[model samples]
Target: MPMPQEYQLASQHYESFLTAAREALHLTTRNQTYTCVQATLLVFRHRLTAEQILMFADTLPAVLRAIFTSGWSIDDFKPEFGDEGDWKAEVKAVRVDHNFSNDETPARVAAVLRQHVDLPRFEKVLQQIGPDALRFWGFEASARI
Candidate 1:
């Protein structure tokens, strides 16, 4: 496909995420990876404050950024999730039609997301959400770098 000149970089970023998410989740289709990325982003996005969410979205590649913020409802701020299970459950619920086999999907998705985004910028965004953000994204102290 011939991406527009402006879309080149954005496509590259999305492709990077697609490749990472697909391999991480052991999914076959780019569509499944896309769904996983969207689901994962929604899981994290709802937990963030409005300010943090905007800032984080701005830092993402264009296509992924839109996916991150898509279908968001700010009418009710989501409560802080307790652990990986809580967040994973929400993600699965978002994509209920798909079966997420590995119990570790959330952590694996987070690991792939970290690989794709600009870590320093993401770390700054994470700071706004606090330590729970780090744990929620499955990033440890070492992964912060």
Candidate 2:
């Protein structure tokens, strides 16, 4: 089925945000992760459009199932834009570096996001994504970077 333009565009924007989050949260040795941001974005997008919510809602289960059962690599998930795609699989694509500290991840992410994207825009994306998507991604973040 053909996806609506709004849904496509929103998805694209969300991907952009994901890239930004990854860049913002980069660590030296520990991998940079964005499951939190991704989950929040999915929830935010859901708030903006019913179709987007439905579409993402449908796809997420399968992706998680694949992650759970098949042991697919998170790095295999292609980025839509120019992101370097240097991430690790933790139920979702999370960036990790062998040198980064555990506690620095979230703060680094927040800082990078502030540098690249504004607060309102960030919150807007999170607000639109649905609860289920948030919960799904949240599961991945059970062990936060």
| Candidate 2 ranges with C-alpha deviation above 4 Å | 1-6, 27-32, 36-101, 112-145
RMSD of 1: 3.7
- For residues 68-133, write the lDDT of model 1, one tens digit per residue: 887778853677646677777777777678645355677777888788778878877776667778
Candidate 2, residue 10: Cα displacement in angstroms equals 1.7
Best by lDDT: 1
- Cα lDDT of all candidates, in order? 0.75, 0.37
Residue 84 error, candidate 2, Å: 30
lDDT of 2: 0.37
Which 10-residue window in model 2 sums to the lowest lDDT? 80-89
Q: What lDDT tens digits, residue by residue, belong to model 2 across residues 95-114?
A: 33322323434344444444
Q: In every candidate, how many clashes are there?
A: 0, 26
